[model samples]
Target: MPTVLVIEDEPGMAAYLKTELQFEDYSVLLAYDGLEGLQVYEDNAQVDVILLDWMLPKMDGLGVLRRIRQTDDVPIIMMTARDYVSDKVAGLDYGADDYITKPFKMEELLARIRVVLRRGHERATYQVNDIQLDTKAHSAVKNGTFIQLSQREYTLLLTLIKNVNQVVSRDELLDQVWGTDYTGGTNILDVYIRHLREKIDDDDSDVIQTVRGIGYTMRTAGNDN
Candidate 1:
C-alpha cells in the first residue's frame, strides 16, 4: 500500500480525509501545521503523495511545498479554500502536481490522487548507470549497494543522473536542488559536488566529471563520448 501524507491543519478536515484515504487502503501520516508537516516529510521521505492545505500555521502550504520541491518531486495535491485561478497557477508553479478546492467530493479527490500517483511512478522507475533511485523507497543504490546521501546531496545527484552525460550548469543545479530562493552562492554547489564525488565516485574516480567554467557532467572518465 502507498503511504499518503495529509498536511491539513483543521482537525475535522484532517480526520475526514485520513478516513477516506484509509478506506481506500492507503497508509496515512498526518501533520497539523506546515512546520511539523515539513519535519514529517523529511522523516517519511518515502511518502508516495501529499495532500496539503493552503492555509497552515507555523508555515504556509506554499512554503512547505517549495521546500519539498527543492529536494524531491513527491506527488502533491494542494487543498485550499482559495479557488482563484491565480491560486491554482501559483501552486502549479511551485511544483504542486494538482490543486483541489475545499468542499470537494471524495470521488474527485481520489481521481486526482490516482493521476498524480501514475506520473510519480514513471519518475520513480527512471535510472542511469546501473544506479536506480527508488522513489517509492526514498533511497538509491548502485549495483545493489546503498548510496547514502544527505537531502541536498540526493537532490543534486538525482539532477545529474536525470541528465546524465550532459553538461548541467551551476545555475540550473542551484535552481533545481536548492530552489530559486537559495542565496547561498555558487560555492555551495562546489561543496556539494565535492561531497558527491567522495561518495559516488570513490571507487571508480570517474562517475561525475567537472566541465570547468561550465558546470559538471555525469559519465565514465576517459570515454570521449
Candidate 2:
C-alpha cells in the first residue's frame, strides 16, 4: 500500500483526511506541524507522497518543501486555505508537485494524488527513438552516447520525450519543467530547447522541432505519420 504523510494542523481536518485516505487503502501518516512533518518524512522511507498544509505552528509549508527538495524528490501536494494564485505559485515554485486549496472535495484530492503518483512512476525512466532518460540516475543517453544534462535541461528533455510526437504547448512545458510559479518568460524555454538540441542532436538529424507559434515536438525523422 502507498503511504501518504498528512502534515495538517487542524485536528478535525487531519482526522477527516486520514479517515478518507485510509478508506481508499492508503497507509496514512499524520503530523500536526511542519517540524513534526519533516521529522516523520525523514524517518519514513515508505512515504509515497505528502499532503502538506501552508499554515502551521512551527515551520511553514514552504520551509518544509525547501528542506525536502534539498535531498528528496518525493511528490508533495500543498493543501491549504490560501486560495490565491500567488500562494499556489509559491508552493509550486518551492518544488511542490501539486497544490490544492482547502474546502476542496475529497474526491478531487484523491484524483490529484493518483495523478501525481502515476506521473512519478512514468518518469522513472523514459525512452524515445535512440534517446533515453533515466530519471533515477539523473542521466540521459542518445545512440549509446551518454549526454550530461543540467537539472533544467534534463527536466525539459523528459517533458518533451514523454509527450513525443505531440505538440506540447509552451505553458504545459513550462509548468512541467520549471513549475507553475515560474517567473521566467517563455524565452527561457526556447533557450533550454536549444541547449538540449545541442547536446542530443547530430548534424544530419534534429529530434526536437519547433511547431511554429504553437510549441515544440520530439519525433523521429520521417515518422510524421
Candidate 3:
C-alpha cells in the first residue's frame, strides 16, 4: 500500500486531507505541526509523499523540507496560501517537488499527487503472463486486447497480480479492496471475482483459481499453482 504523510496545522484541512486520501485507498499519516511532522516522517520509513502547509508551529515547512533533503529524496508537496511566484520558486529551489496554493480543489491536489508519484517511482506497468496493467494510466489489457475494468476490478486485479502465485486470503482482499470497515459478507468478494473472470479469464479455464479454504490465487497457463 502507498502511504501519504500530511503535515498541516489547520485542524479542518488536516482532517479533510486524511479522509480524502484514505478514501482513495492510500495509507495516510497526519501531523498538525512541523516538529510533529518531522517526528512522524522519521518514525515512518515508507512515506511516499508529503503534503505540508507553509506556516506551521515549532518550525516552518521549508525548514522541514531542508531537513528531509539532507538525507532522503522523497517527494514533498507544499499546500499553502503562499501564491507569490517568488515563494514557489524558493520552495522548489529548496527541494520541494511540487507546490499547490491554498484553497485548492481536492481533485487538482489528487492529480498533482499522482504526477509526482509517477515521476518519483518506477514504471507503472505490471505484466503477469497474459494480463498487463498500466497503473499510472489506470488501464489494463489481456494479450494486447484492452479489457474494460471498473475501479474495484482494477484494484482487485492489481492486488492479485502483485501477489502472483501466492494465495490471498478472503480477509486480506476484503481489507485491501473493500476497506477494513466493510460490513458486507464474503459473497461480495465472490461476486467481484466472477466479474473479473468474465473479463480476463481464458475460454478453457479460469485464470484465478480458488484456494479451497485458504482464499484465491491467480495462476497463468502451465504454472498450475
In the predicted model 1, the residue pairs found to clash are: none
Candidate 2 lDDT by residue in tens digits, 1-225: 999999999999999999999999999999999889977975675689999999998888998898777445789999888789998988888899999988999999999999998988444667888898875456789888889877678778877887888999999888776656569778999999999899998898879999988899999667774
Clash counts per candidate, in order, are: 0, 0, 0
Clashing pairs in 2: none
Candidate 1, residues 87-204, lDDT tens digits: the string is 8999999999999999899999999999998766445644766677765566878778998888778888888887887999989999887667678778999999999888776564
**Which 10-residue span in candidate 3 carries the lowest summed lDDT?**
66-75
Quick one: ranking by TM-score, best first?
A: 1, 2, 3
Clashing pairs in 3: none
lDDT value, candidate 3, whole model: 0.84
Q: What local distance difference test score does each model get?
A: 0.85, 0.85, 0.84
TM for candidate 1 is 0.71
10 residues in a row with least lDDT, candidate 2: 121-130
Runs in model 1 lying further than 4 Å from the true structure: 9-39, 55-73, 85-98, 105-120, 220-225
Question: Which scores better on lDDT, 1 or 3?
Answer: 1
Name the runs in model 2 displaced over 4 angstroms: 121-225
Tens digit of per-residue lDDT, candidate 3, span 1-225: 789999999999889999999999989999998889977976776788899898999888988887665445678899878688987988899989999998999999999999988888444677888889875455789888999887678778988987888899999988777655569888999999999999998788778989988889987668884
